[model samples]
Target: MKLISWNVNGLRAVVKKDFAEIFKELDADVFSIQETKLQEGQIDLELAGYHQYFFYAQKKGYSGTAVFTKQEPISFKQGLDIEEFDDEGRTITLEFPDFYLINSYTPNSQPKLKRIDYRMRYDDALRAYMLKLSADKPVVLCGDLNVAHEEIDLKNPKSNHKNPGFSDQERNKFTELLDSGFIDSFRSLHPDEAKYSWWSYRFNARKNNAGWRIDYFVVSQNGKDLISNADILNDVYGSDHCPIELDLDIKGE
Candidate 1:
């Protein structure tokens, strides 16, 4: 099975930039996207042979997530069950016979960590939610989690030390999540790889290869063996973030 995740930054904008061709080129069994930044009826996508599911934020043109799968899910849901967090439409869960897939767009802590408290609360809630899902089935969690867990996860880590995504608190929470029985698929596959997925438009960040590996495909420990390959498609671009892929040996019912 091939699963892919990307933070489109803005779905409508991507569509105008050959998203359809890129989506068809990837040809994944399950494709997930974050930071859709759309409200209901904002746009429509016609992806033949795929089941499209969207969870849009209550706030217009803001945080949102969606999933497109060739296989029908046994069940699915939106959000982490907290009203405040749910209001942002940051998560979507799809249950297959063999595993639970959670597509998430973790909230950014913002400038000067202005939203650190809320971001921390979100981290706690998400960790608990993923644990609950893992207890029942191996979980596959992916998206622009908005944090670079370690120094190796970004270029110029020293300079970005106190930045929003590289803050000690955010990184520690990510560590706590992994410690709770999950594996960062990309890192596990390529321990010394310096590849990154997201970059800023300013200062020619992408051109200079100065980027952050914020997008990920994380799985429950039990599901680690199922991952055949984990890749960062940095060459393909429409948004600030590139697509990350996971090739699994598991089968769906």
Candidate 2:
């Protein structure tokens, strides 16, 4: 089975840039998108042969997430049972027969680490939530986690050490999550590969390949064997962030 995750930045904006064509090219069985930046009725997308589910934020043109799957889910839910975080429409959990698929757009620790506390709270809560889900079955978690876990995850790790996404606090939280029986699929497969999924539009970052591997496809430790491949689609462009793909051996219910 093929699964793909992308932070489209903005759904409407990407659509204007040939999102449909790119979507067709990928042909993922389950496609998840984050940072959709939309509220209800902002736009309509027709994805033939796919079931679409969206979680829109209360605020217009803000953080949001959505999923498109060829196979219907046995059950699905939005949010992590936290009112404050749910207000941003940051998560979607879909249950198939064998596993739970979680797509998330984690909160960003703003510049100067202004929101580090909030981000930490989110990290702790989400870790607990994923643990609970994994207790039942394997879980496939993906999307822009908003942090570069280690020095290898970004082009200039030293300079970014204190940056919002690369702060010590945020990175340690990621470490704690992995220590709790989860796997960072891409890093597990490509230990030495230095690739990135998100780049700033400024300083010609994309052109210069100065980027951060903030987006990910994480799975429960038990589900690691099911991952056939994890990839960063840097060539595919629409948003500042590119798409990440994961191929799994498991199938839909």
Weakest ten-residue segment in model 2 by summed lDDT: 244-253
Please provide, for model 2 over 1-253, each residue's C-alpha lDDT reduced to its tens digit, 9 standing for 90 to 100: 9999999999999999989999999999999999999988888899999999999999888999999999999999999999989999999999988789999999999989999999999999999999999999899999999999989899999988889999999999999999999999999999999999999999999999999999999999878878899999999999999999999997541
Alpha carbon deviation, residue 215, candidate 2 (Å) = 0.3
TM-scores, each model vs. reference: 0.98, 0.98
Mind giving the per-residue lDDT tens digits that candidate 1 earns over 1-253?
Answer: 9999999999999999989999999999999999999988889889999999999999999999999999999998999889999999999999998889999999999999999999999999999999998999899999999999899999999999989999999999999999999999999989999999999999999999999999999999988778899999999989999999999898641
Collision pairs in model 2: none
Where is model 1 poorest over a 10-residue stretch in terms of lDDT?
244-253
Q: How high a TM-score does candidate 1 get? A: 0.98
